[model samples]
Target: MNIVVDAFWDDEAKVWVASARDGIGIATEAGTMEQLQQKLSIIVPDLLAEDYQGPFEIELIARSHQTVAAA
Candidate 1:
């Protein structure tokens, strides 16, 4: 099965963190982007193998500058 993974840098921890918003919403952290990707490769499969009956949809919102000011 195909899954989408999002990775971002966490300034507080000074590391890269990744999350799979679909399925089980699995998340992991690593010292670098490459490391985070590698960790996700291992994590995603293990998460899928779990007895989770998940087909969840996650909604992500990104606000424009104007929208941010209004909120």
Candidate 2:
């Protein structure tokens, strides 16, 4: 199965939040991108094991925003 995870940096929360779509049930948040990725590594397998069988792959898509002033 192909799992797609989308991550976004929440400035107010000061953490990276991620969610899975397209039939993948996943939602989590972490202080950093690395932490978030690590969480997915463990959480994904457990989630998939419930309904899916055999090997699975994950595709992560992340988005972040920042404002820059003209120099």
Candidate 3:
């Protein structure tokens, strides 16, 4: 099984946040992208275990939005 998550940069929160794009109903945040990725590895499996059994593969899809002032 494979899992796909969507990550976004929250300017106001000043952290990286992620959610399950495939409807796994998971959301998490971290100070950095690396940390978020690490958390996902651990989090996804644990959440899945609640209703699923056996091995699984996860793929995270990250997205960020940045606004730059006109110079």
Candidate 4:
């Protein structure tokens, strides 16, 4: 099973939030991108069925925006 996870940096919240399409059943936040990915590995399997076999892939799509003045 291939999973698609979306991530974005929340300026107000000051964290990286991870979300997936409906039915993926994943929503989480972390202070950094690395932390978020680590969380995903652990959470993904638990969300899967008990009968699901080993080996699944995750596709993480992250988007972010920022304002840099006078670059």
Which lDDT tens digits does candidate 2 get at residues 1-71? 78889999999999998999885669999998889888988998898887878476778899999999999
- Per residue, candidate 4 scores C-alpha lDDT tens digits across 1-71 of 88899999999999999988756679999999999999999988888858477576888999999999995
Instruction: Candidate 2: list runs displaced more than 4 Å.
Output: none
- CA RMSD per model (angstroms): 7.3, 1.3, 1.7, 1.6
Misplaced by over 4 Å in model 1 are 50-71
lDDT of 3 by residue, 1-71 (tens): 88878888888989988888767788999998889888988888888896888587777787887778999
Question: Which pairs, if any, clash in model 2?
Answer: none
* Local lDDT at 60 for model 2: 83
Cα error, residue 70 of model 1, in Å, equals: 27
TM-score of each: 0.61, 0.87, 0.81, 0.86
Give the least accurate 10-residue stretch of model 3, judged by summed lDDT.
54-63
Q: After superposition, how far is residue 70 of candidate 2 from its true place, in Å?
A: 1.8
lDDT of each: 0.60, 0.88, 0.84, 0.88
| Candidate 2: residue 47 lDDT (0-100) | 81
Q: Write the per-residue lDDT of candidate 1 for residues 1-71, one digit (tens) a residue.
A: 55666666666787766666555678777887667666766666667766644553333221212224555
> lDDT order of candidates, best first?
4, 2, 3, 1
For candidate 3, the per-residue lDDT at 54 reads 51
lDDT at residue 36 of model 4 (Cα atoms): 95
